[model samples]
Target: MSSSYAGQQIAFLTQHGKEQVIAPILEPALGCVIKHVTGFDTDQLGTFTRDIRRPGSQLDAARRKARIGMELSGLSLGMASEGSFDLDPFAGMFPWNIELLVLIDDRLGIEVVGMAQGPGHSSHVQASDWPAVESFAAGVGFPDHHLVLRPQDQDDTRVHKGVSDWTGLKASFEQCLAQSGNRQVFVETDLRAFANPSRMQHIEQAAQDLLKRLQSCCPECASPGYWVSERQPGLPCSVCGRPTSGYLTEVWKCGRCLHTSVQTRTDCAFAEPKHCASCNP
Candidate 1:
């Protein structure tokens, strides 16, 4: 079954070499051309170094980028990727990254999203000397991941960004330290896609997810993006034979035609006792 997107031109608005990883996975599978559009500075929407604040939520930002790419290239289809960094949701101990790839089909009047999240490299440190800076860089995977520095604290505008080499990072650290009002330099991992390999890997994963969604044709209308949209919880506990906090049915929905399909698990009909609310309680 061939996709409707085959032979179509999909505009991608990105400056940080995202096209290199995303296009390779998407183009071959979908048979669509990824038109790299780059006239606009995407940093105006947001920045990892926190120079410019992001105006809206992550989804809104991704949608805006997709719209911009579509407008610039005059294409009916467009896609964009946006990444966010924060503490991990499970423990709130380690840094975490979430990458979102949004595809907008103007002709079909629908939007599809692909997402992936995992451990990230967005961390910061304040150091008053070179030894501390070196230790922090060593822990954070610098050179390969890149580094950004500012005097005194993260809010400082006098920043040195994209320092890859150890020599450059040391020089930038010295420069920031000398200019520091309190003999301190604030350093952090650069979160840009080109600079951060870990985050870029997540972006590639999101691209693969996008490919999967785009290839999943709707059973009713034969449209792309026919994937699970909701989960219904009613799995009976294996021990108690009572409903538990587990998904029993998956509601698959199509973005284009609003087609719906419900799939129940055949592999497992009972939730573990540990997952059962009544039994565990």
Candidate 2:
């Protein structure tokens, strides 16, 4: 247990059995006991199933969950996590997953977020026959990871989620197939933490990030979660000696007192000439 939060109890809000992964990482790292807070429908904030669209940004949703947990458990410190899936922005070819974990301390009026992103397996297949469905399942690591079934058009409200076995998947496929006017069913990997090992690993990484932030303390006010708040770009090009769109400094700020410090990258001193407009042009 770290010195700051030793022997403390933090409330974690979740409905998808996320505690199974999160608790194991956070409890030992932070030296705090995590109490799962239930009875609230976290799906109201959003869902991966597309049943209810997410209302706000991932950070906003995570903060809302943390606050709800605090209110329910009557604890000053709370934690929550949210995940989003999309195409990788840089390459725009492979599926990407962004996992965010939020820690809120009402006692200090501070909130900190830890984030992790990587390639994800979020593919979906629309098929009408059993052979195609089976092929898709095999490709997605079925039985180990779960699947969700819905109408091919993707507008239908009815969805069968958390289908792990072949028997359940076949039944769900036939049911969704009958409901679809085009006799097609949409099958996708279940993005839930417990259902997807890859997603759960990302969540664990986010928890580790949170642990690091929690361990970091502000030099000015001695508050936890002192981290980089902004990046200062404009690293000079090696050839042209002109500024490029590369980061020059990282602005670390204290979450409580807003005290800031600028630190330069230790990896490289100058940006490549290829990144400089003047050099490249």
Candidate 3:
């Protein structure tokens, strides 16, 4: 392992206290300081509250933030994080969170990304009375997870964010109820990293993933972040002895010199019968 980023300052732009989780993991391990850049309201780029629409994809937003941080601090190395919420990709039965940390190294002329996904806390409800509001808040892990409230529906522009305590929640609920034209107040869990513990956990995991990627060195060019670029599916079915959907090899590649190599999976040589189209489907 090479210390390519040792003794370097990586600029990070965040207003939601992401540094609390990111700095502790990467600073000591990478021997770099996470320069927390301020004076910019990241909410202008996009917000989970739906007030300001996020431009471009999740990766694009992260790259843009990293560039902004580098420019503000006059550093060649920069990093930024972004998170998105959706239903679980496997079954679409539960809320899911996907967090991305983008590292842009102008000195090395390369970009690397670390990603992680898991269960998320994002829920909403329309309530007309205090009892209903209490039920919804209890269900979403209020006071710790935090919340956002608005009048009428999810699209209502009158939103009150970061309601933590029970007293404050009741007050906000009344305020929204009074402001609502339909007499229904909308309440949801606040999706901010600092406010939501679930989202913060995923962000921390993303930082760890980034550290692993940075530690990996390319065999040919000796560049950092030589990681799996693609997966090949061809593992023979255990019962039928035929190719199945199970992956057989991982294609590794370098980000700088573009050197590539393939490694066969040694953990398992055959796919289960359930995964094979010929044997089960």
Q: TM per model?
A: 0.98, 0.94, 0.98
Error of 1 at 102 (Å): 0.6
Runs of candidate 1 exceeding 4 Å displacement: none
**Model 1 lDDT per residue over 112-185, tens place:** 89999999998899999899999999999987999999999989999898899999988899899899999989
RMSD (Å) per prediction = 0.9, 1.7, 0.9
- The local lDDT score (0 to 100) that residue 131 gets in candidate 3 is 99
Deviation of model 3 at 28, angstroms: 0.8
Candidate models: Cα lDDT each: 0.93, 0.89, 0.93
Error of 2 at 257 (Å): 0.9
Deviation in angstroms for 126 in model 1?
A: 0.6
Instruction: Quote the lDDT for 129 in model 2.
Output: 97
Scored by lDDT, model 3 comes in at 0.93
- Writing each residue's lDDT as its tens digit, candidate 3 over 189-264 gives 9999999999999999999999999999998877888899999999999998999988999999998999999999
Q: Which ten residues in a row have the lowest lDDT in candidate 1?
A: 1-10
Q: Write the per-residue lDDT of candidate 2 for residues 1-281, one digit (tens) a residue.
A: 23677789999999877888888887887788999999899989888888889997999999999999999999999999999999999989888999999999888889988889898878888898999999999988897889988976666778888899999999999888888898888888999888888888888899889988989999898889999999988899999789899999999999899999999988898999999989996
What's the ranking of the predictions by TM-score, best on top?
A: 1, 3, 2
